[model samples]
Target: MTDKSIYRIVFHNQGNIYELYAREISQSAMYAFVEVSDIIFGERSKVVVDPSDEKLKAEFSGVKRTYVPLHAVVRIDEVEKEGRAKILPGGEQKGNVAAFPMPLKPPID
Candidate 1:
């Protein structure tokens, strides 16, 4: 892969759909998890600020790597370049695509 390679990762998290861009992505050592690192964000301008982008930046700040469950991932694609990283409303069902249902809590032993 070229150094300029960028990947767009879309996934469902806590009722939100997250769109993220990263330089590195691979299967995690942890079972059923995807490892993502080197997150990229759009350059910010003082003229305007996006709340969604800001929220995502704050949430992922200082995070070196993240593991996402396989079932939660909507899709991953290699794009020509990085794009704005933001979170979209997951509750709305615009397309036929749907997120896989997952239990909110683990069963008690």
Candidate 2:
């Protein structure tokens, strides 16, 4: 594969589904998080405006790398080209979509 190959990462975050394109996806050193870097987004063109994509761009604007929880990841695919990054609302209306629950901390004696 060429160095420019893009990867599409689909993951769940705070009851939302995030679709992102990046050049790198790997197991993070930070334990159970997946490391994603070199995120790719469609160029700003006057002809088209995607609110979902715009929201994602602003959310990840200053981030160089992101570590996503492994359990939240739904799928990952290597693609020939990058696509618009977007965030989709996910919940009961989306059918069977739910965020993983975190374990409760033990009570201090």
Candidate 3:
């Protein structure tokens, strides 16, 4: 999947809450599980993609790796630009993340 295809994932697990940034490996898969900190919660369970804004968010469910329609995701444009290649949220961007290079933009057009 492309970087724009990913966002932060948040959900409740066993009543214990957890958050992760999931990189969508494809339209059907995700990779790169990053724990999330400093999250914003509201009665609104959804957010919209902002073109001008570069930040992305993730969603998650305690029951499974994925739940809820990705379309329900508000921001769908902001993608992970991991140098040279892009990686979905649940997945890692190309390259050894251990080195952690700046994410590069994926060809979107």
* Best by the TM-score measure: 1
Candidate 2, pairs of clashing residues: none
- Per-residue alpha-carbon lDDT of candidate 2 for residues 53-86, written as tens digits (9 for 90 to 100): 8888899999999999987888899998897788
Q: Write the per-residue lDDT of candidate 1 for residues 1-109, one digit (tens) a residue.
A: 5678999999988878899999999999999999999999878765788899899999999999999998889899999988889898766567787546732543579
Query: lDDT: which candidate is best?
Result: 1
Checking candidate 1 for backbone clashes, the offending pairs are none
Q: How many collisions per candidate?
A: 0, 0, 35
Query: Residue 21 of model 2: what lDDT?
Result: 98
Cα-based lDDT at residue 80, candidate 1: 94
Residue 23 error for model 2, in Å?
0.5
* Ranked candidates (TM-score, high to low): 1, 2, 3
Question: Comparing 1 and 3 by lDDT, which wins?
Answer: 1
**C-alpha TM-scores of all predictions:** 0.84, 0.81, 0.24
Could you list the CA RMSD of all candidates, in the order they appear? Answer: 3.7, 5.0, 15.7
Question: Between 1 and 3, whose TM-score is larger?
Answer: 1
lDDT of 2 at 45: 70
RMSD of 1: 3.7
What is candidate 3's lDDT per residue for 45-87, written digit by digit as tens? Answer: 3386432122222332232344433323323333353221112
